[model samples]
Target: MMALQHRYPLALAIAASLLSGPVLAQSAIEHHVWQDKRKFEPYSRTAESITGAIRLSGNNQFATPGSKMTITFGNGKKAQLTSVGASWRQWDDVDGKKVTAEVFKVAKDPGTLLNGNTLCGKAAKYLVFHESLSFGASLLGVAVFEGSKEPKDINSPGLCGTFNYSVD
Candidate 1:
C-alpha cells in the first residue's frame, strides 16, 4: 500500500505536465510574432518641396581638370549650369597621405522643385551625387535621405555642398 501511494503521486504529476504542454507551447509561439499597431501611425502630408544648390569640386593634384559631377532629382530635375571656374589649394589628408590638394569647383544652377503623389501621404528629402572623369572612369558617390517636415540643409562632397530646402 505504501508503494502504491508513491506511484499515485508520480502518475498525477505526469498527467499535469502532459495537459499543460500544448497550452504553453501555443502561448510562446503567439508571443514571438505579436506586434503593437499603435506605434506605426503614418504621416498625413502628400507632397514635398525642395530647394537647394549643388557644387562639385575635384583635386588638381591628380591633374583631373575635366572631372565632372552631376545632380538629378526625382526624374527630370537636373543641375542648370555646367561651369568649372573656382580653384583653391589646401592641405588635405587623402588615404592617409598628407598633401597640398589643388581643388577646382563646378557650379550647378540652383533651383526649387516639387515631388508629389507619395504613398502614406508623406515624403522624405534626399540628395545624390555622381562623378565621372573624361577617361571613362566613374566613381560612385554618396546619397542622403532624411524624413522631416521642416527645411533641411543638403550638402555633399564632389557634389553640392550648400543648400536650403523644405518638405510639405
Candidate 2:
C-alpha cells in the first residue's frame, strides 16, 4: 500500500505535466494576422477641391500586418497612414507654409462597404489634419485641413476624403 501510494502520486504528476504541455504550446503559437486588403480608387478632381493643386498618389495595400499607405500631396506634404493608438506626427510644407499634423482614425456611422466588405469600423478610416498651434502673441499660426463638404458618400473618391477598402 505504501509503495502504491508513492507511485500513484508520481504518475499523477507525470500525467498532469504531459496534459499541460500541449495547452501551453498551443497558446504560445496562437497569433492573429490582420488580413484586411484595400484598393485605391483613382480620385477625380471636382469643381470644389480639398487642397489647391494638391494631388494624392499612392499604392493602396493596407495589409500584411505592417503595411502603410503613403500619400503625397502636391504641396510637399506627405501623410503616412499610422495607427491612432501610437500617436504619430508628421511635418510638411504646404504652399511654402510650415505645418505639423497628426494622423488618426475615426469610426463612421454605417462605415464603408466595398465588395461586401465593410471598412472604417472600430479601426477603419483615417483622418489627417493640422494640429492646433499657438505661439507668442501676434505670432499665431493656423493651418486648415478640409475634406469634402458634400454629404457622406463612402463611394466618392477625392483627395483628403474618405478611404474605402475591401477586406479578405
Writing each residue's lDDT as its tens digit, candidate 2 over 1-168 gives: 678668698887788899999988887522111112222222223201232223233323322223454443333344545323222233222233433333333323223232333323232345443322223111111121233332122222322333211111
Q: What TM-score does structure 2 among the candidates reach?
A: 0.23
Each candidate: RMSD to true structure?
A: 21.3, 17.7
lDDT of each: 0.30, 0.32
Off by over 4 Å in 2: 1-43, 46-48, 52-62, 83-168
* Candidate 1 colliding pairs, count: 3
Q: Write down the worst ten-residue block by lDDT for model 2.
A: 136-145
Relative to the true structure, candidate 2 has a C-alpha RMSD (angstroms) of 17.7
List residue ranges in candidate 1 displaced over 4 A.
Answer: 1-63, 80-108, 115-168
lDDT, candidate 1, at 69: 39
Best by lDDT: 2
